[model samples]
Each structure stands twice: as C-alpha cells, then as structure tokens.
Target: MCRLMVYLGDPIVVADLVTRPSHSVMKQSFAARERLTGGPGYIPLSINADGCGIGWYAREVERKDGDVTPGIYTSISPAWNDVNLERITPKIVSPLIFAHVRAAMVGTPVVQMKCHPFSIGRYMWMHNGEIGGFSALRLPLLNALRPEVAQKCPCFESDTAVAFAVFLNQLDDPMVQLAPTALAPLMAATIATIRHVAVQNGRGDETSMLNFVVSDGRTVVAARYTNATDEPASLHYATGSAFRRKKEASADFRLEYHDKRSRLGLVASEPLTDEVADWAQVPPNHMVVLMHSEGSFVDTLVLPIDCESPEVQDHVTRCFRALDQSIADNAPQALQQAPGGIPRALKRPSFATGEDVPVATAPETIFEETGQSVLSVAADGTRVFSGSPAGTIHVFDLQTGKLLHTLDDHSHAVFSLAVADGRLFSSSMRVVNEWDLTSPDGAARARPRLLSTRHHSDGDVLALAAAKGVVIGGPRDVSIHVEKACADGVTQNSEATVGEQKGELVRARALLTDALTGGHVSTVYAVVVRGRWLFSAAGDAAVKIWDLDAGKHKASLYGHAGAVMALADVQKQPSSGPDADAQKERSNGSDAATSPSDGQEERSDAPDGGFWLLSGGRDNSVRVWDTDTRECVRVLKGHADDVLALCGGFGGRFYSASADGTIRAWSTATWSCTQIFHHEDTVPLAIWPTERGVGSGAADGKVRSWLVDRK
Candidate 1:
C-alpha cells in the first residue's frame, strides 16, 4: 500500500541514500518493484506519488533538556521533482530518521498533513496497511478515546491517526512510562477493543491489515500484524555498521554490520536494493523491538486479536476479565522496570523543593586559546591561523597550540584568513595578501612573504569563501578574486566585465567582481560557493542564493531575527583549492585528513556525496537551509549569546562558538549538545573544526585547543 522506512544509526546524510541510488526511494515512488495489487485488467497504481515526508532528529545540539521530538518536513511534491528534497536531504544528517512515500488509499484525499510519520510529543508513527472497515469503526473508537486526546484528534479522519489515538488512550497517564515488552499487549488491547466494535457492526477479521512502527527517540517498537489476510504486509529489516554501498547491491546500500555490537538497524516495507541475503522478512503477526542501548531483536509473544470468537473471548477474560488486566499481564515487571514519565521535573530541593529550570551544560575543556580574530584550521588540519586587529597573522601548530609565526603587516583588524595552494591568505579592509608558511627552520621563525596585495573592495572584509582558485571577500560589497590572479578596474554596478588578467604568482587574474549587481540590502556578512550556486547572508536578516553563470538571484529566504553571523558548506568529500605550502591555503581551510572514513561507525558518510549550508545568526540560532528548495528546515538553539562561528566535517558533527564565552560540540544523532568548552574570558572570536578536536581564538589574545571524542 505504501513504502515506509526507519533508519537508526549515526548521523547519516540521506540525500544520496534516498535519491541517488539506482533503485532509490525516488524510483520506488513511480516504478515500485513491490506492491499488494497490480496486474493487467486490475492495474492498480504502483507509483506512490500521493505525497512524501521526512522526520529526523534535527541534531543533538539543540536538545539541552526539553523534548526529544524531531522536525518534520512534508510536501505534496513528488519525490522525483521535490527540489527541496534534493537540496535539503543532502544537508540533513541524523542518527534516527523516518521517511515515507505515500500512495493514497481508496477514498482518501492526498494531503500533506496526512502523510506518514504522524507524530505526538516525542513519538513518531507510520503505518503501511489499512484498518478494516475503518469508517464503520471510526466513531466507536473516537467515542471510546480519553476526552483529552480525543478532543484534540476528534475529526482527524485518517485511520492511522485514529489508531495512534487508540494507542495513546491505552497509555492512560499524561506522563506515560513504558518498557520494551509493554507496548505489544497494550496494542493487543486496542486491537481487541477494535474487534469488539467490529463484531458489534457485523464485520470480522477478514477486513484488517496493520503494519505499524512507532519511535520515541530512545527506542522503536515495530509490528507487522493483521487479521484480514495471511500476508499482513511485506516488512523486512537489515542491520549494519552504517548504511553504506553494499558491494553486492547495485550500488544502493542497506544496513551493514559495522562491528559485532555497534550495529545500525533499518526497517522497510520493501527492500530498497537487491541485497536479498542481507534482509530478513518479519514474520506475520509478530513484532520487533529496536532499542538504542540493546541493538535490535524480535518480540516473541503473539497477541490474540481475533476476539470475535467465543473461545478467544473466554481465553481473554479467563486470563484477565478486564482489558486493562489483559494489557497488564503482558509485562508484569513493567511497574518497576518502566521509567517514571519525566523525572520529577525539578528534584525536591535539598531542603524545600523548587521547580528546576533546564540549563545548558558545558563539556570538559581539553584545551583553550584566546586571540583577537576568528580561527582558521589548515586544509591539512596541521596548522591553525588567526588574524589580529593589530595587523598581524598568527599561525600555530593545530595539535599542540604552539605559536609558529606572527606576520605583522596590515594595520587593520585581521577579519579573515584563508589557506590555499600551500600558503595562507589574509583579508582585511580593502586588501587581500598571500603568504608562504612553514615551521621555523632551525632557529629563525618563518616570515610570511607578502606575495601580492590587491585591493578588491572599499569596505571591510568580514568573510571569505574560496573554491576553484576563487576567493570571495566582502562586507558592504563582495568581489571574486582568483587566488593570486590580479585584476584591474573592478567596480560596483558595472555591467562591463573584464576578462581575467594574468598575475605573476598564481594562474589567473587577481580579482573579478561577479557580473550581477544588487546582492544584499546591508553589509554582506558571509558568502559560500558550491558548483554554480552562490549563497550569501547579510545584516538584512536575509539569506539569498544566486546562479553564478546566470547572474541572477534565484531565491531569497528570510528567517534570522538579527544579522547573519557565519555561513559554511558541509560536504562528504570536501574539495580543496590548489595545494598550498603556507600562503595559498584554501580560504575555507577544511582539514586535509578526513576521519569519518575510519572505523568510527557513528561517523558514517552519505553515498551520493552532497553538501549543505549551515548559517549562524546574531539571533542566537543556527538554521540549516536546503539549497534546492531554499527553505529553512531546521533551527538549532542553545547559545546564551550571539552565535559567531560554525564548523564541522564528514563526521556529521559540528561546533559553535558564542559571545557568552562557550564553545559547544554538537552531533547530528539527536541534535543535542554533547560537550561544552569553557574558559575564563570565554568570548571565542573564531572557531576552527579539526578532525579530532576544535581550536579557538578568543578575546584575551590567546589560542586554545580541545580534544573531542563522541560516545
């Protein structure tokens, strides 16, 4: 009837997995290889294009202490043409992800809200089969629901929603406590209750098909069940270290064993690829328990849902005359093993007892540094660069934080430093300079050579982005400079574009202003380039995307409450410019050695190998936007002050620095903050992400470093 999948692993970028595969979810949307009904005369709709959705734990950074619910993005757009899906999916990295492509049931209207992965509180659910005689049993079930839940979902037409409502009612407590073995019997009771109503309406077991999955961040309980047919629904599972290209499966991937214990679990209505041996079919009328702490396995006890028969009814009552008792008997140890709904909120004060307020907790500080400018880690990650307002560029050993050199030349604040082509480049008010850097040879410290000084803009340089030998630096104005390639007579609002002028050092010209005019209303705070797409953020609280070749603004997204602080593009295989010894480092300065490729299962990489943009703002929030749809999909919040910088790698883990003097480490798993780096002066002017750690430049003019290890 529909295609539904649940992936529980380390944060994985899903675009490549869902869209890029040969027989990807996109192909399944139109040319499904598996279905319940489809032949010549009765050629039913095999394509599931009705609608689709994705729900994922936005990231582990934003969860300080509140709910563990994920952010949902649904659209009526078909998966093949969902531009947002293409742009945003690559950007999203999650440990727990729920995705579904829908094929509207007979008599049902296709609506976005009606899409699968329906959610409530911290739980998310999706169903693959239909409710037998749903219409006849709808009112009876709604009428039977608790006033609170029913009142909210009264007219929620969908049978799936109704079933969830029934499940909620079975919980009884506002703050519900649950265990792995507790869900099956409550489900049995709900089905029994439905069966009772069905019999009252003269309907029987032959009318139902129910395969459902429910996840609450911490755990997942999935069941393949039905009373109507011997074949409840096609459900299969695969477990692995991470979802990677199965060498045996047509380049598409499936769950793979990363290790004996650190297994990644996946469940789907149909196998996404051709690796038949890797997938295990779930037995009809049985359930599977997937625990975050205990890998994945099946739940044995089958339920007695066919209560319409006299023998079944007698058996149900003989065990426990009441339905609650029947539900209780399934998990006798639940009363003690189940968690108390939410800890007493605020533990009783040592003396009296006051409500507890959740506060952001910081992580261990393995290293700390204080400096004046933002921090830049070399593409190789062996060096950290800092530019100071005193017109000096400071280079330090990334691992040990040892100062390597201090080149004082610019009289203005060293706002940005870019490393490319074996050299370090410094950008400031109106000027860009390149330098060659190396550890002090023998005794004398390495002095950076002033390769070429080109005035690319009249305004200050607040940000820099370099790709394919092009470095874009600007504030009120942004111009494109080709590494050391020099240019002459570049101005604003000029339609006359000069060809690349040859320079002495690098290949092409010195600088070239992009052809288009009128980029941003206020100061352009940041800019990033990927392929032909150009993204920029400004003080106008607006983020705009443009086509470099077309020279036009494609879409403008407005969300930040204050000025945009920083912008970054996180890609699977980060591309670096010409290999530079010192002065010519790629402006972005991503590390050379990638760690996700290592045996770290949680740092799994995406297959399609795409990129995403991360923007931090003065509003103290960071928004991840899908370049294709140009919509802000997720917002991460936790910093006490304005967010100044954002950086991460293939590990799908990122770090943020704030004016509150704290540097926080975040993982994509649950979008929760994993660690906090703190120090005396605290104001981290800039942050550089390392494969294994983070380097920071602070207000106190000292560089700090810290080692990060995620569990």
Candidate 2:
C-alpha cells in the first residue's frame, strides 16, 4: 500500500498541497507513520519513499501557450530530495491534482514507470494497496485492455499500473464511456473482473488493497475499497465551499476546512492536519465523486458498490453485446418517418389514426462510446456525430447502425458541433475544424485532407449554429476567471510577461463583441437560427431571441429558473407526401430549413404560425416557448436532476437528457413525457433528435444512438 492524495476544487499550489503541510504528501513518502501489518508483527514497509509522482491539469494557458498535455512527473527518487520537484512544485498550480508516494508491494520494483498516476489522453489514474497475487493477476488484466490502450500503455512492474490497465479496459469500452457516475460501476466491475480472473488462475488467497482514483482532468472519482475479506487502508476526505491554507507562507501550512456544508471535496490517505473532526473516513466499498459545482466549488457524492447488484449484470450484458455479433443482427430497426409523423402500425388504441392496437414504446437500441458534450445529427439523417471529453468525435451511419468514423482531431474536448452543407463543424477552445462528410474513411483522421481549420481568438466557441448560409458562434470562456484570479496574484510569478499573457485571456473574451446582440451577461451555452430569427441561451437564465439579419435583440424569453443549458427549435409543419420521391428529397437536404408555412398548415401548438423553442435547464425542467408570443406553453418535468440537453421533432416527440442519467421522450400533443429510458448508468450530457430516434453523448467520452422499433 502507498500514500495517495487527490485535490478537486479551486486551484491550489502543489507546494502547499503536497509539500508544505506538517504531515504532507512529502512527509508521507519517507515517514509514513501508520503502516499496516498483515498479522503476527509482519508490518509492511514504513517508508513510502521508493518513488513519488504528481499529476495535474497544466494551466490552460500552458496549453494555450503551446504545452500540449497535463503535467505528470514520476520519479524513482524520494520526493523529499527530488531537486526537479522542489523547483517545479512552487511554480505549478491547477484545479485538479493528484500526488502519490509509492512503497511497492513485495514483488513489485521501484522504478519510474511503476510510479502512481498512469495516464492516457485526458485520463489520469492511480492506485494504493496491492492486488492479491498480482503476478498472476497482471497478465490477464493487461490482456483485457482495449487494443489501442494496450499498445500505448507502458510496460511496468507495478500491480497498480496493471489494475489501471484493467480499469482502462473498462473505461475505454464504448458502453462504459457514457457518463461519470457510470464510471463507479465500471471501476467496480474492473476490480471484480480482476478478482474473478485471479481466483480462476488460483491466486485469490493473497491480500488486495484496491483503493483507486481516476479523473478526466475535470471530474474525479476515487474509491476506498478492498477484497471481500480484507479491511481497507485508511482513506478520509474533507469538503467545504472554501478550501484554503492561510495566505501567509508557513512551514506548518495545513489545508483549512471552512463552510463545511458548501460544495468542495478533497480525498487523501490520511488527514493533512490535526483537524481530525473535519475529516470523514471513506467507507470500505464506496466510491467518492468530486466535480465542479456551479463554478469552482465542488459537488461530492459517495456511492456504494455491491458486486452482486444489477450493475454487474448490465455491465456484463453490455460487454457481451459488444463482443457478440448478435447485436448487428437483432438491432432495433427504425421505422423512418418524417418529424411529427406517427406511423399507422403502432397507432394508439384510444386516438387511433389507423390501427386498433394499443400504443407501446418502441424497442430501445443503446449506442455506446458516445461523446459527452455534444451530439448532432446531419439534416439528411445519413450521419450522426458526437463529441467526447477526450477530444474525439464519433460518427455513425444512421441506416446500418454502424460506426463510420472516429475523428480524433481536437487537442482539447470538442464542445460545439454543427452540420451544414455536407460538412461537420467542430470547435474547441480556439480551433474549429470543418470536415467534409462526403470524403472517404481516411478523411476522418486527424488533420484530414478535406478538413478546413479556423481560429476564433475571441473566446471558446461554446455553441454553434449553421443554417442556410449564416454561421453564428455563441462564445464562452473560463480564461477570464484565470485572468481575474491572476490580477489578485492568485497565480502570479515574478515574471512580468506571464502576467501580461494572462491579461490577454480576459481581453480575448471581449473580442467577439461584434456578434453579441444586447450582450449576454453570461456564457452562451446554446445557439439556433431559424430564417432571420436567432435563439440563444446564456447563463442569464433567459432565452434571448435575436433578429439575425437586423443584428438586434428581439426579446429575452424568461422561463427557466436555472441556467438554460440546452435549446432546440422545431418549426410547425403539416403532413407531407408519403411518396418515394419526397422521401428521397427529405434524406438529401436539411429538413430543419424547409418552411412548410409556404403552403402547408401550421401545427396546432404554434397557433401564430411560427417556430417553437424547447429549452432545458439546470432546474431539471424543460419549457416549451412559442416564438410568436414569446411565451412558455408547457413545462415538462420528468428528469430528477439537471437537464443538460434537449432534442425535438423526432418522430412526433421531443427528448431531454439529464444529470440523473436518463432520457425522457415527450409527446408532441400534450408536451408530456411519454417514455423515460433509464440509462442511469451514465450521465447523459448531450441529446440530439434523429430521423430514426435519438442520439446521446455522456461525460465518459462516448456517443451512442437509440433507435426506436415498432412492436
């Protein structure tokens, strides 16, 4: 076992968190005061000074200034005398950080590659405690890794690294990449998979300390756990709104806990100071979640892992489903229909359009490895795309229900995506790449030949809307926060040029003022354009409608009590021709741009004959607003947690994805939730309306589609 520490909340200096405390992570390395004993006086190593490691999300500025990935330093030398660490620790600061000191189990080696904090892409993982009979467990666990991950994972003698490999296998599973909460079970199953293999290989008798931690550089998940009979190593956490040590430099600097009820959490192997009362010990079989609250403060959740629970079955089923060929054969078929068109085959008995049979929900087909932040469907219904937390984009073919391409183009997470004129627009902090979807397989690769790149120096392109010929970008950036904090000397150094660059980040936020109509007071999270009308949702808790052509604010529609996180626009339409020629045209062009008002009747919901805007919010409620009157017609409430995304005009229904990990489908007539798909396994962050059904992306850097099939 070893000493492990995880910090998730406001930014803090590595020197203070890992070095300055009275019993700091540095102290733990050479003088671990509480080493555990097996039995009969056989105490494990007292000094965890075999090696040390620190992993942190480098300043976005560091990356903005050309530093590519997060900083991860692992050394075979003890941290107490590591010259490089001493020089770097004081200068480095980050919101998310992990520092670990190692005391290798009996069979493991003391080497740099065997240090804590194993990382791949944006994911960083670490472990304390040993795997029972690790040598026996190692090969199988390593073999279980995803081929891509296996190839990339460095060869190391540490059992912790192998456990991380197993965890990586579960993590990179397309199904496991749904959401953050889904990670807990996937992690548990990874441990279970290891133990099952260990037992099968006849190595189950040894001790196993499986306390583990992992993060995607934003959301942090840590577990204090052990095998069936073993007691866990010490693990405690402290959380509050304010996490600070005194501003004054002192050798006895200890993290002070204030505002105990507020949102912020930190996990460590032991208490950082003598504030024993403020620290709470983690339960043996539970996982700790730490994520940013509304802003910088953290929201924490502790969940139990019951190995025999249905989670295991679901995880297993998903794994089998992926490996087996049966899924492609038994895949749910989409009864393709124009939006608002209810097919006659499954007509409700009470309000029958043609059939006398009772209506039932269609069979659910879950697509795996969906990106978390954004999901967008091509207007023609031929392609569906999702953006991942790992800076990847997954593209799927709607007809065959098969993955077409995985575009790993962005150096940061792809936050905004839009489809226009046979091209996909993907934007991150600064770079925007437009990919020509009509190109071949090689065209989906990073720096694809047909791809065009553009830079938005204004700010992060938080939302994107591409329609007809107008491309509107709604910007948001966290750089301003960094700049503001820098002014207060939060990250100040003696260097003057560094301070000026931080100021540039704030000025960058003001650069895109030309596009702002009446100036959104907060980060713009959504953007949609219909004809000359543009709809956007910002942190101001209001949906602003602007006239794109006039470049002026029309009205600010207020309804959502919390920040409006998602928005979808559906134009009222009358029944269209069922002829083959009409269907062909519908598949070739964006159905969203077609104006039925030219000849067809407007849907009853839009009495004034205009488009309807459906918006979802952090309040866990969705409000349907009529653009003509700028009034909310209905408030849909079915999700138990914050609604992160909304999708509408999919086969006469609307869909919303929530933080509680579910998708609720709404009826067009009543604006009521007709079906709730409990994908509670993953936090669904993005949802998109598709001609066949719906597509969703979760926090775990995966994307999937749900195809509805008639009974």
Candidate 3:
C-alpha cells in the first residue's frame, strides 16, 4: 500500500509532514515500518518508491491574491530521491496539507497522473489501499457517475482516480462547502457504493483494502477499511498544540500538547514519529474526521463506517439503478457530441446568423454633469443612483428623469454602487456608506439619509455588492471585506449624524468584521451576492464562489484569458411555447445542470428561482455559468474591447458595457446579442437595466438612457 499523510490545524511548513519528521512520508517511501505485505497478483514490498505528491493551501503571504484552491506538486520520481521536493517543501507552508508517496501496483505504469493526491476543483484525495478486483468493477463504477462528474474525472488508468470520481458523484454540489460530519457519511456511502458494485459484478469475495483520505482545505476525512478479516492497512492520527521536532538537527519529532484543545492534527497511514504515545491507531472500518473550528482548534471525531447496513445498501442500490437508467438513455446522444463531450447547451453555439443586429433608438433621457465621469450606476424601480469621480452620488427619478438629489459624503471617487434592502450602498476609497432611500427628514425632501458607514483597512473599495443583510466590498488590495448585520437586522454604530436641520455630522461606523482572502490571485474587480453565495471576479481571470455563512471559498470558475471585470446574476425565467419546450427537451441530457442536486437540500440559503451567473472579462467576452453545475454554459463574444460593466434581469435581456464605447444587450433565451447602443467619443463605464431599456454611465460625464423596442 502507498503511504498517505494529512494535516489539518495550525499553519505548518510542508517539510514538517513530508520530509522533516523522523518517520516522515519521504522516509516511509524507503522504509515503511507498518506496511502490510502480500496482495492478489501483486509482489510484496516494504518500500513505496514509485512517485510522490503533495497538496496544500497557500497562506495569505504566499500568494498575491489569496487563492482558496490548494497548490499541488507531483513527481514521478521516488519521494526519497526527488531533489525538487527537498527544495520546494521547505518554502511552502499551509494550514491544511496532504502528502502521498506511491508504490505502484504490479503491472501499472508509473506516470505523473497516477500519483496520489488527485484533485478536482477544491477537493483533494489520496488512497493508500486498493479496490480488490478493481479491473472488473471499473466499468460499472464509471457508468454509475453522473454525466457532469464523469466529465470532471481525470482520464487516468487507476482505481484511485475512478474512486475519486465515485466519491465526487456522491456529492450533490462539490463546489459548495460541506461540514465534516456531512462529509464523513458521504465517504462511507462511497465505500458502500463501491462494495455494492463489486458484489453485483461477482467480486464480492475479493478482499478490498480501501484507505482513503479527502479534504476541502478546511476539513479532512480519512477512512481505513477492508472487507477481509485481516487488519486493515495501518492508519493513525496525532493531535497536539503543535507538531515539530524537538531540535533542528534532531530526528525526534512529536506532537506537543499544551492544552485540551487541539491546535494541530495529523493523520497518516503510518506513524510519522518515533514517539508511540503521540499517535493513536485508527480502528479498522472506522473513519477519522478533522475539522478546523473557531478559536484555532481542530475538532477530531472517529466514527464507524457502516457500509453493510440494510439502510445504506438500499440507498446505494437505488442510486446505482437510477444512474444505470440515466446512462442507458443518454449514452447514445453523448457519443454523438463533439470530441470534448460537453453538453450542447454548455457549448458556444455558432454566431454566423446573418440577421441584422438591432440598434437602440435615440436616448429617452440624458442626464449630463460637467467635468465628472460617471463610474457606477444602480437603479431601484423608481430612482436611479450614479456615482462619479467628483465624489458625488447623483440621484434621479427614473420615470420622470428629474435630478432629485446629490449626496456628497465621500471625499474620493465612488467606484461602486448597489441597491439592496431598500437602501443604497456606495463605496469610495476605503469607506462604504449605507443610505436610507426614504428620507429621514421627510419624503418631500426626496433625498436619501446617511444611515451607516463601513471602513475597510485593506485599500480602496473598488467593487461593492449587498444583499440579505450582508455587504461585500472588494478592495484594490486583492481581498474581500464581508460585513453582516446584527441579529436586529441593523448594525449599530456609536456615531449618529443628525438631519441637515441639526447641522451635526455623524461619522460612519466601522463594519469590517471579517475579510475573506485566498480566493483571488489579483485585484478583485467585481463582486455580486446571490442569496447566501458571494461571487467575486478578479484580475486573475477567475470568478470564485464562496459560502457567505461560513466565509469559505467553495469553487473557482476559470475560462477568461484576462481580468474578469464585471458580474451579474440572472434568474432564469420560465419559457413558453413549442420552441421553448423543444429547448428544454434538448437540454435534458444533463438535468443536474438546471438545478441543485438532492444532496444540497440541507443548504437552506441556496439561491432560489434558478439563476445563472453572467461574467464579463477583459478578454472581451461574457460567460454564462449554470450555478448548479458550476460550468460555463455559454460564451457570448461580440464586445470589441474589455467588458467593464454588466446589469441584467430586466425585460428578458442582460446588458454589457465595454471600453469599446458601446452597450450590447443579449437575449437570455438565445444567448445572442440583439441590440447595441453606442456612445460617441467616450467609453461606457457602467450600465443599469430598466423595464423599458437600459441606462449607461459613460466616461464623458454623461448618463444616457436608451429604450429598445419590445417588438
């Protein structure tokens, strides 16, 4: 069996677990002390020397923009012989780590992809044991996976890769955060599914050794299991305040315990230190869970894996039957698609339609301000709010096009504006101010009253989004500041400003409570909140999804070749007529693409009303992503320059404004550009869609509203 080790606790250099320990993973590659001998059709060897891999989450200081995904390094060379590992491990540090040294099974080729610690999206997995008769059960296991999961599966000829696929299939949404308690059961179920598949295929009697460890950066779940009566491959875990060598030159490394709370937790296929008391053996058929909790503590749990239970067996059988049925129905169509095998709905369709693209009629209303470039715009049914470099927020009546108010609370240019919860939020420099839309003095005043202000320490807040009592601001420093309202639905600030009649100034309250880093690798350009999920786009050309409740990164979407500048959430409207029905029929090849999987039922805060995310990037394209599948469903390419702003969910069309000095409106149904509005001599910096048409904020200090003919 291969050797595996995982760390989930305080930040530690990769060398601490991979090479520095007396009985480290690197040392075990040549001298494994507790490795079991003999397996079907395999030569017994105490040494694991085929290859090695390590995956770890980068600390904030390690990368420019905080990245949530782990950085992985793998080598086909033996762990003990890999010179690069020695030099690299000492420089990388992480709070969660997974390292593996593989001893390839007899007849299996040694390749880089075959190395342990296989990863897909945010999750990383490594296996120390083999699935007996894996060759016989491989086909059935592959066929059991959902189409999307099957597509994500690496094309590797190893049981570990297929097992990882099976595990991912057990998750409804692998792109979201999952608790260790919830994850452990899924691991057990994955093992159950594998056993059921093997038994159904006449490999039930084969002794299967399945030692698996999986982690999502924050939580780790490891299992040591075997159907045979012989003791499973050695697995042990040690918890302490820290894990380090007693002396720099000494080989005596142990877990240092200072208090009851564990600040360091390490799991390994074999002990990594000579101190026997520092490690505890994981019982056979049991899984160990290590979850990072508050107060810098790692909570550990050891639970039995009950795969043979009648209830679990029934569930697996039903799931397998359903998957079989699905494959039988869609396999033919899937084979007929492009070599990429991506569903037709998720592919970019031909854009050769010769039909004339419509041009928007002349401006219905134009609001001009001398010497002030409009940088951001937002609308709330009756009124429009536009932010300018002149440090003023201009409010106007949407229907009447009347200049209603100019709020001048900011001393710097306001780069972002968002309307949420009957309030307006504007960000300038490092401060975000919340304004009550209904005047605090009286409605006759027609001016918003300042309610609260949040100060960010990172840098100037360039992007802002607010929803569900949570405000998210992306600063120029490449981090996201998250502020949540208290239980009373309001954040109380000690400083209060009296109305204009009182002539008293109120300093905005500081609401920068938690900041999420390691999600982006460059300057965060845009941020949007959909339900409880936060979508942040950055100059790194990636859009990252985060769980707002836990303040954890869920998944990253990569496709843009340049900085992603804007983001919008569009709720899918129910279609009508025969053509709409036919469209739905065509998309049935992947039903999971349209909605959350059954496993996401526990996420009560999941966005409602089926929404798709639209992201615009400096690559001059807009991407439509299915929130459920976390896959880019479509790429709308027509922008001639960098797409700087996006606004949608009005009149079945979404608007995109670009540096090319034009605003293009795309039909949500056809994913085609239907109308384009040009601004002469200036670029459109921001856009806000209304019931009749769209409004644009241009660099030329003008705000123009264009109306499109419904027909």
Q: Model 1: per-residue lDDT, tens digit, 359-411?
A: 23233232234444333333335666777655667766655666777777775
Best by TM-score: 3
> Stretches of candidate 1 above 4 Å error?
38-45, 173-177, 246-251, 294-711
| Model 3, span 1-711: residue lDDT tens | 788999876667788788988889999999888887746544446689889999987654554454556788999999999999999998876778999998876787889988978888778999988898988888999999999998888754789999999999988877675644467778998999999999999999998899999987667899999999999999987665567677877877865433223566788988888765456677688787776433344555555577444423332233222222222222122212222122121122222224478765368888745457678889888888888765789988787766788899987668899988777889876678887776545564478877677666544577899886667898654568776532223444433432221332333222222112224534477998876788887654567777776665655565664557799988785651114223321122432132222234454434443888889875578888767656666778887666888988477888898766678888887777888787766777888888788898876777889987676
Instruction: Identify the candidate with maximal lDDT.
Output: 3
* Error in Å for residue 398 of model 3: 2.0
What C-alpha lDDT does candidate 1 achieve relative to the native structure? Answer: 0.57
lDDT at 21 for candidate 1? 64
List, residue by residue over 308-405, the lDDT tens digit for candidate 2. 44422332223222212111221101111111222111122121123222323332444544424343333335666766534667767655546766
- In candidate 3 the C-alpha lDDT for residue 281 amounts to 71
Q: Comparing 1 and 3 by TM-score, which wins?
A: 3
Which pairs of residues collide in model 3?
66-518, 66-519, 67-518
